[model samples]
Target: MKILQITPFFFPSIGGIENYVYNLSTNLSNKEHKITILTVNTENVQKEEIISEKVSVYRCSLNFRYHKGLISIEFIKRILSANDYDIYHVHIPFPLGLEIAVVASKIHKIPLVVTHHGEYTKGNVFFSLISSIYSKICRNISLKYVDWILFLTSSYSVSLRLNKKIRKKIKIIKTGVDIQRFSATNDGAILRKKYGFTANDKIVLFVGSLSIYNRYKGVDYLIRALHEIRSVNNSVKLLIVGEGKLVSELKELAKELKLEKEVIFATSVSDEELPYCYAMCDVFALPSISGPESFGIVLLEAMASGKPVIASGLPGVNDVVKDGITGYLVEPKNVKQLSQRILKIIKDVKLGKKFGRNSQRVIIEEYQWANIVEEFEELYNNAMCKNGDGGT
Candidate 1:
């Protein structure tokens, strides 16, 4: 089927939502289904959108508040009107995504499927109120001919707070990665050794776009957990692999806690280097708080890298990591519990390896992009099955 994915940013930009579109669309493209992305016309992206035998990217050069293409409603209309896609699938909650999809559904008489992939319901009061307005608007537009809402986790499914009737339209589909591209390896032997990390020192990695809003990615919790963790084992080192506004502050706190030498803030690491970073880790950590993280993509990557992980026991992360099996899940923002779990993995080498292997097994079974896209393709066919008529 021909699928058109609408989002603000695409490849070259780093984000979970962007990864969802890239990996799923590319996987579908490889399967001989036509896939195209409608995104922002950032200065760096010269082509409006890429078109190939199986995949196409259409970039609209319109600026909005935050690269959301919020300023160019007509541009979105043009993109939607120009394409004769079998299904219009949107991957975000922005005005552009909902607006363009709504218009396209009306003009083209296609079914509209929205994938709510974030924790939109847990933001601050102002955002919560604004999101309420947008959610209502989205629900109204969706209810007209909505076929399905693909939520990344049941937690997010509940977070959307859609009416029970509308909730029936929700389906739980975990975000996926290219498992073939990521596999269990030991980047530590060469990569870590060269990077001044000794085999003796435990390396914990965190990857994501850090912002002021998500400082409690539980990175701070990791730092706080350090006081307890390092009391006995001081060989633990942290590799924070992302850049954001909180970089400078985090650096200072590391110094204040005397962990400056123990923590490495690594941003701008290339894609080729990412797997190695994960492979080098003795264990991986994704300590995101409830609502701060909708789905932990890094957890799967860690599993694929054959590294045991410890994530916050929030809905999305817990849904992925099975405690004492694939990985352990502790309470959100609980530094003590997080520290204790970290100590467990570090202390018991056998249990650590067991968790890592189990993680690999589970991720291979459920988190691979090849398997995940089929679920999406099915949803798309259902969405497009509905014509332009407001017939539900």
Candidate 2:
């Protein structure tokens, strides 16, 4: 199958949607499916680069930005000109991309599959009102035309409250993790020593972009919770892995809380070292405070690393982190509860290990990339059949 994946961001831009598109495209390419990624040139990298015999990337010139979305007229033009794809699978929250895909599907009579990552929920009052109105218009039109809509979890699909016709088009497909790369066997000793973290220190890991646009991630809440945890347990350390515009602000917050020594900021971590970062943590936390965080992919990565995890009890996130089995789930932005959950795992070694074991088991049984790719393949075939094209 020749698949064109349209997204707002890709490699060099670290985020959940970017990582999802990268993994999905690469995995499909490995199965001998031709995959072409169409994304904005946010980082001004190569315009067009072939990743493998079956995989390639084409970065469209970015025109500008409107709030959180990147606007690229070049991207829309490219989509209009292209007609050779067997599948047009676009990831959204990208309103322009979805609109163009709807147009392209009509023009070429091709199957269009949309993966709705989440809604836009990070803006002020006026912007939020505008975003809501624009989202409703775009979603109604796109849902009517798209061949299928993939969601990260059934709970998220239910949250949308789509009518019966739209619900029929929904398929629940969770984001996947590279289980082999993020296993328990990967040693974190080098990373620990590099960060001056002694064996006695219990590391609480948080990985995500620290951009102001991503304030919904609730990193400030996590920092405050760490401050609380530190009062009783001086050995507890917060290791934040990722870099963005809000890095300085987060650093200032840590300093203000007198946690300069307790908080370790790893800003220059490479892709190859991410697994080690996960391996070094005693507990992983993602305290996202809003709807934009539909699903937390980092939670899965940490779980695959055989680490106990704690995340907001948001609809999609709760589906990923089982409240009592794989890890605990606290209310979004609850600093006290977040601290208590982290302390529970850190203080009780046996419970933490049990959660870690369950975490690995869940990853092996459900969230492996190979298994996820197979699900996609099946969905693609079904989409083609529905479009009266049979199979590729």
- Top TM-score: which candidate number? 2
lDDT of 2 by residue, 1-392 (tens): 99999998888889999999989999999898999999899889889988888889999999898677778889989999889988999998886788988899889888999998988765788878877877767677678889999999988778885778878889988778988899999999999999999999999999998877888999999999999998889899999998998889999999999999888899999999999999999999999998888898999899999999999988788889998998899998789999999999999999999999999999999898888899999999988898888986
Count of backbone clashes, every candidate in sequence:
5, 0
Off by over 4 Å in 2: none
Error of 2 at 356 (Å): 0.3
Which residue pairs overlap in candidate 2's backbone?
none
Poorly placed runs, candidate 1 (over 4 Å): 42-44, 49-52, 66-69, 121-128, 136-144, 388-392
TM-score of 1: 0.91
TM-score of each: 0.91, 0.98
lDDT for each candidate structure: 0.75, 0.90
TM-score of 2: 0.98
